[model samples]
Target: MVFDERLVMAFILENAIKYGGKARSKSVLGKILSVKPEYRNAIKDLIEYIKSKIEYVNSLSQDELLKLYEEYKDYVKTPTKAEKKSPLPPLPNAEIGKVVTRFAPNPDFVLHLGSLRPLIISYEYAKIYEGRFIVRFEDTDPRTKKPKLEYYKLILDDIRWLGIEPDEVYYQSDRLELYYNVARELIGRGYAYVCLCPSEEFSKLSKSGVACPHRGQSPSENMELFDKMLSGEFKEGEAVLRIKTDLSHPNPSVRDWPALRIIDTKRYPHPRVGVKYRVWPLYNFSCAIDDYYMGVTHVFRGVEHKVNEEKQRYIYKYLDWKEPTYIHHGRLAIPGGILSKSKILKGIREGLYKSVDDPKLATVPALRRRGFRPEALKNIILRVGISPSNAVIDFSLLASENRKIVDRLANRYFGVRNPFKVYFKRVSHIDLIKIRKHPDYPERGVRRFEFRDEYISLYIDFEDYSNIISRDPFRLIGIGNFILEEADKQVKIRYIDNDVKKAKKEGYKFIHWVPVDHSIKCIFIYPDTTYEGYSELNILDEKVDSVIQFERIGYFRIEDLGRNNINVVFAHD
Candidate 1:
């Protein structure tokens, strides 16, 4: 470690300029130009770089973030590795405990439904306790790896959008040498052995707890064998680092697990490092090493990761590090369907759902775009509460929860779909298209309607009016006045669109409707079909999903049809 007084003086000098005599305030700047022993002054320019951009930093926009990468690389790098300038705060117990946690996500694809929950829980736990939560990309699978890194931007943006933004970021690919060093250390200590067990015999070995030929080797012999494995002297699957443990024990940790595998380094160069090495640590090993190096104190995740935790604890024990607190929660599963990312991505690739934001799935952002508020989702999850059992919840429960949040919120509108047109020759000259926007809540206000007697028509849904056999007068919607007029043997009925101030005067039945002419090109319909609802206890579709409502229509958001086609999934009524 070389000592450099000029560097420390420079850092303090820079901090003094930024924070007056409290040079301690600019911790990030102080660290950058620190003239400390073993600290390099090469990074001193980082402070000047930061100082030069007081105006430009404020000017930074998300759109120009990528472009600034080349110019502001240090601001980015500093956060990951402590650009913190403030001196340590006084400890509560004469000992300040630092707790670190990482939200490790595999970079195989963009985030999906199943991935967010664990990350959300982990992030909150870390944040609430005033601990560090780092975002680390588990990018070991070379075939699925990508260089665009744009997905990372989306991941961070979505996290921010969800209000669970990560504090720092790390890439697992950046630490291959650390993993290799640790792997070699394990081999030297006889804790890990190079197991050259053939593929045909592995299933027999794991299931039956039987030892293969390599199980009896000495530590020296194992080290030589490991060296061969790392040198690419063995085929991809021919050799692996098997942690020597009690294969016969009931716990899976006692079962020998592969720590490293020879991979095709050429094809899967580290996105940042590029083909620097060939042999690589598997997820379990890399994860364990990462947790130890980063001093992670807690790991809250789905019970699905419980199996990994079984063996992972042993690695922590071997390294003499404190095992992170593990809290396994049952996954949030919706019945009648699975939340498999592969299956969902497969469906998207095959054009099954149109895009990841398909209406059917309760995808976080999709739920948002479809009008599910952020706190609405959190409220839904909280109301569902904690359950230990493998539970299967109906989507209806979530829809109901969401509905409660948006109630009395947006202006109501009438949407007439599966259209059946109606006209009355009697009302063409009537100047008043009388209406109240909301019948129940008069204070919500109203919009005037237009009626051209001969041309006036109402949009009636196919399902409700398909059988127009009602015995009573169906109120004319939107116009607020009506007479049932007539009903066929089927449930369907035909009548004049009405204008009304009270239910008894206008007619007993209420339906939704839209005026023929509106300023918008879109057919902005409200809940014309709320009158005929599903047999279910709650009329949720009229309340949730793809529709966005402008008026107090039981169904608010009526999707518009392009010129060639109009299609809607049936309202589960």
Candidate 2:
């Protein structure tokens, strides 16, 4: 049986482009040689053939490689259609149009990948049911975890970038009066009481299931005490309002959970409202009150809040209000990623991180700076769904998803890292090399390059030079085939032919090159380091923010660092 080399080359190229120019030999062998019964007998020959052509296969530019894929993707294994991310399973007892969801974030810091899980989940659930989505800020604490006014707007912008515009927005700082009224109602109904016990005494009583003496006060007395507590009469830590849950409950923390406390605003004034009020509601009290009044039919929160959910149930029970449907998904974390706000803040303060957008962090600003698309984030969240299983995400998964989105549009350019000079010895006329701006998008027009003459010296990477075997012919990408005469401190090549088919037939390796005279200095910022390289001068004309593939290297976002030095942020390979 005669084997069609075209079909085999196409399969090799497809796998190469998918895996960033380097397709494993075992992977390609298993797909073609092992899978098909008729081809199994030729496995040994196929292995040798692959060994000879692997270097040439890996060096094909994105456009040239994908062009082969488009022609022969149907032969080996049909490329699977991308799976559509289904909507989340319906909320229990949730009515179609009546379902309401909320993403309440503390505005102390910028949103990170961990925070985006709830945002995407809640926003998508609301979108699925055609219901209202609420964006609320829980910023009542003026002391520790104090809200920064700047992050409030930054959070909104991040939400917008994620393709969500909240139907209703609320800030806890602006709803203090409402929270105070709700606390008064709880006191008036005797479902809550003023606790005047010292911190140590309350801790012992709560642990021993013994109520404090103040827990037995009459509703009238409690209301007066609360009134005094709300006024400037009570000093900080002198009094606190506690919801009256079963004191005998197994979880001691659930016994009489603190609802409201007096803060010494004179010492820690709020960023927004300043010292306008002294009484501040803790998380559960204010959140429970708002969920009831704001008509939040469903609440999506991290599973770590299961205890808080237990405490908030009492508030709903006391008010005789229906508690919002609670969906507690497991926390999403990136292993080895900086997700803690305190650590990130500390790093910033210590100058370890230039800003929140430092490429090392997983914060929203950092991801954006690192060229992560919002679509990639949305796809990841939707794929994970609301499963209770804790997800420790791998950054490579995100990079792969991002590559799928960017590969379709990112233009290909010639760039060489650790460049070395290569001079072609044969004389010939100048050649006009027309390269596509985007491989798949030909209508984008071709990027023209003028090769002065056949006796041209071009800049190629030392890595590529080291890989080439001396005396063997290889194709110089879009230019022509050449034999490496010398490969030492300086590479010397003699022109062979301009036929790509002859090079492929001979299993000659292919490499990328840039005209030495038409190249620019480039700085590529990676997640952990930066690379300085030389790229074809055509890259200089690309607009800032343009995401382009650096030939066989990776995709990078162009940034105008000014002064003729092009800076790019590496997205992925």
| Model 1 lDDT on a 0 to 1 scale | 0.55
lDDT of 2 by residue, 325-345 (tens): 776777888877899999999
Best by TM-score: 2
Provide the clashing-pair count of each candidate structure.
Answer: 44, 0
Off by over 4 Å in 2: 1-85, 453-455, 469-471, 486-490, 561-563
Against the unseen true structure, what C-alpha lDDT does each candidate score?
0.55, 0.82
Model 2 alpha-carbon miss at residue 244, Å: 0.9
- lDDT, residue 274, model 1: 70
| Worst window of 10 by summed lDDT in candidate 2 | 78-87
